[model samples]
Target: MGTIELLMQGFAVALSPESIMFALIGAILGTLIGALPGLGPANGVAILIPLAFSLGLSPTSSLILLTSVYAGAMYGGRISSILLNIPGDEPAMMTCLDGYPMALKGKAAEALATSAIASFIGSFIATIGLVILAPILAKFALKFGPAEYFALFALAFATLGGITGKNQFKTLIAAALGLMIATVGIDISSGVQRFTYNSLHLFEGIDFLIAIVGLFAISELFFFLEQHAGDGLKKVALNKLKLTAKDILFVMPASLRGALLGFVSGVLPGAGASLGSFVSYTLEKKVSDKGTFGKGDPRGVAAPEAGNNGAASGALVPMLTLGVPGSGTTAVLLAMLISLNVNPGPMLFQQSPDLVWGVIAALFVGNLVLLLLNIPMVGVFVKLLSIPPKYLMPIVTLIASVGIFSITGSAIDLYFMVGFGIMGYVLRKVEIPLVPVILGMLLGPEMEKNLRHALVLSDGDWTVLWSSGLSIGLWAVAAAGLILPMVFGSILRGKMKRSKDGLVD
Candidate 1:
């Protein structure tokens, strides 16, 4: 059968009453889980895996439900980022850079609405891409070896100076500190502990989720206590609650660009939504910023939202086509599929066309459901800003505390979280950007592992790093990333200033 006929049959299955019902339930549940700080999509899907089995859901029905949740969680992650400056997940961290700034500027409603639209656009496009390009992208992703992966990570780190557009020295310090922290665990290549301090808890190294919660959520709590400020907690303006046509038009190009970048990133195993978001925000800041990107520009909110959601959808490509999970959440989904005896690979399309295409169709449906569900709730989410700090701070603390403890069940991790929170507070006090620290922590280990693996494979020949055309291209991009920022940073700022002053068109 042709692709269109298979897709149409899959839609027939996905549109069944039972499938639609499961999709709705999954979408709502996933959104709630995602809105809670720290409990991201992976946990959400994992939590429901047992339930699917207990209920004896068919393979198609269970897959549809879980995949819907995955999509919904991606959409919901922006909520905490925009309202509270706490990312609901790692991928949402970039959203907090500008989304919270928009909230502080009393444009919280606009930011939320704009993000919802951009997310829809991104997921819609990525789902279409998945439908058309899954096999081809899977094959392309196989071309990335250890050297290419290392260079890709290098490109990510090289972009940080431009992403933050802050003090390069301070950013380097923060990133270095993160890399140092990542080295605390036992070395995979050597099995020797580096900085565990003879403690059992440190053996596994710091969990990035715990670090993220502490750094963003707990630190924000400290800031709240210090300021005790309720001045910015006014009710959202109803007049600005809805998105204008100009606002839609203004963010459309950035969203499109971000979605494309995010989809490509997601296609590559290990690149994931975090990189998609980081790259999208960095590129948008370069391409379209008028000095307002990190200061609450709607494009800033739109770009990352689109990027992350696009990556979320695109991550399924490798999972379904090659049986290689592209992101962490998809890893969990992979295990679930294995448990259900559904072997995903090139043969999955031919052997279980009904199950495979049903899930894809459900993803398309779930995107629509999320878009419809999120837009009407913007006013509700914006009301979070009106809550006084005295009452709200404790709730934030409680949520972060509970979420972390529930995930790790380790008191030491909680203490570590508090320590990281203090560290984050102190870093912010010195005018240091926190995103680079998180970025380093996220990518440092992978970068090191890939570099080591490449060296081992090449028998310590360093030239292997640049031998492949892909690796060489990535190296060139990394070099350009480091150099172009320094060259264009001042020029862009100058142009933005002139534009603001009516001296430039």
Candidate 2:
């Protein structure tokens, strides 16, 4: 069928009564989960996996629901970040740089409104890109072999390192940690346990869902406890919550630029929403006339919000088209796809055109709904943040634990969950970036498998690592990721020092 015909089929599926109900439920629940400090789309989806299965939802229906949740959570994150200075997720951190300041200035409603509109714009733009470019990218990715896949993974790792900037080292460290976690199960190639330590449960390996929930949701509970409790929410006037036409017109250019930049960065490995927000903020700083960027420029709020949402949408491109996720959240999405017996890759388009197109189409609808939901209901979301931390954290923990237990029905998984939660909390206290550990865990097996296969095919020839031109190119890029960032940091420091000495020329 032609693309248009295929999309029509997808619309029929997405607009079905059951799918619509599921989408609405997901959007509402996702917004609630994401509005809670530290609970993000990844965790939200992980926690809901068992629930989806309990409902016996079709794979397509489940995906639509989850995707809606993803979209809503992305929107919901801004609410807490802007109002309470507590970022709902890592990507929302950038939003807090100026967002909280605006809230403190009694512009909480305005900031939320602006962020909502920008999010809508960014998501819609990226969804359009997904619709148009998905098939083409899928066709190209179909050409990949094992070697090419390895090279692509390497490129993703390197790109993530570069895109993460100052925290790149921590990102790598996190990725390495993840790889180590992934090594715990039995070695399929050898049919012997590797990190099982002779435990019966270890033979199956650490469950990614358990690990993700512990790392994000459970760890966040500890942080929530440590902070001075009580709700940090502030009441804002409803009349003041609406955005002026001038406000929209003022931020239009910045939001558009940020959306475009975010989409491109999101498509690259490791870039994700955080890098997208960072780049968009930098560009806004360079271009905007307002000197109050750090204080509370509307543009500041608009840029990162737009960029991150765009990046979130953009991150899906590689996940669907290449079967390689660029971030932790996308990794979870990938695992979900695998569990659903849906293989995401080039052939996905041909094999499940309706599924793919339905998702893409739903994104368009979800963003529209989010914009409408957020603008009038900004007050409601802000009120959600008003729940006392003590009450909220316990409930969140209960949801997380119940969701996890339901998945495997294993007490052992619960133990792992708690243990990893402690580990995640400890790691966060040391100022490490959590993203890298996830990257390592998710990609480690693939990397090892490809490396082994390449060597075996080359008869244990060590030089085989550099045999393919693509392989060589990827390694070179990885080398650059290590070297160039340092050089750039030094150059930036020198320029700053020179400027301070009044030697600008």
Candidate 3:
């Protein structure tokens, strides 16, 4: 059957009463989980995997719920970012950079509304790309080998440079720390401990959830306490939530640009929403008017929101089409698929049309559902800003701690989380960016695995990494990503350098 016919059939399946109900529930739950500081889509989905099975859901139904949560979490993450200056996930990190500034200027409602609209646009673009490009991209991805995968990972790291903070050196240092942390577990190839320190818990290395809670969520509370002296950010005149026609028109192009760019980045493995949003934000900043980016612009909120949702949707392609997980969230999703006896690969479209198409259709429907659900609730989310610090901070901390403990079920994780939170707090004080550290921790091991795989395939010959045209092209792209940022931002370098030295504005 043609793609249209298959999609129509999928929509029929997804639009059923049961599917629609589950989609709504997933959307609500996803947003709630995503909005909660430190607990992101990955944690939300991971927590639900057991519940999905216990509920006796079919594979299609479970995936509908999970993906809805996935999409919803992307939408929900911006809430804490805009209101509280705390990012719920990696992609939301970019949102906080500008969104929080807008909130400080009493435009929290405007920022939230813009983020919702942009998210819709981004998800729409991703759905279109998935419907039209999945097969083609899957076909193209079949050409990838270990060398290409390694190069792709390199490109992911390269693209992340110099965007996190004023000091590239501090950023690299943070990333190296993550890399070292990622190496603490057993070596899969040699079956030898690397840095376990004879502790059984160290055998599994650090749990990603523990780190997220520590670095982003818990650390944030520490900073908030110190900065505010246990007070919330002062909010102002936050009861409005309507977007003007001109505002809509103003952001449409930026949203579209971000969605397209995010989709392209998402198609590649390992380059997920965080990278997509960061790149889109940087590119938009370069093109936008001066003094409007970091100072609080609606377009700033719109661009990253669109890019993040687009990248989140686009990352699913490789998971469903090639059975290769892109981001950590998708990896968790992939695990659930396997556990449910659903194999996702080249044959997924053919063998499981209902499952595949149903999920895709649900994504389309869920985007609309999230839009409707969220747009009306913008004020509700914005009101969260009004909660006083003494009450709200403890609630946030409680939520974060509970979420981490539930995920890990270890007191040790709590200890480590606190340690990392202290470290993160200190790093922020030193103006170090946490983005590089988080990305490095997540992506470094995968890159190392791919690099090792390529070396093994070529009998330990390093040249095998650059043996293919695809690999060469990817290397070129990686090189360009590293060089272009430095090249284009030379004007900002002196200012940033001075900022690091406390010598200039």
Q: Which candidate is the best by TM-score?
A: 2
- What lDDT does candidate 3 reach at residue 399? 69
Query: Over all chains combined, what TM-score does candidate 3 have?
Result: 0.69
lDDT of 3 by residue, 361-442 (tens): 9999999999999978765654554555567656667766776666557788889988988988888899886656666666
lDDT tens readout by residue for model 2, 1-505: 6778878888788777777777778888888878877778877876677577656677788888888888889889988777767778867777887787787778888888889989888888888777777788988777665666777777767666544444556666777788888899889899888878899998878877678778777888898889837665655454476578999999999899989998987887656787687678778888994668767788988998889899989989988998778665777777677767887889999998878988877777778777878888777776777678888778878887887787788888999999988998998888676656666676678778988887788888878777778667767876776666566755643543342242111
Error of 1 at 353 (Å): 12
Can you give the lDDT of residue 46 in candidate 2?
67
Error of 2 at 499 (Å): 18
Worst 10 residues of 3 by lDDT: 496-505
TM-score of 2: 0.88
Off by over 4 Å in 2: 93-107, 162-166, 228-234, 241-247, 290-297, 485-505
RMSD of each: 8.2, 4.4, 6.2
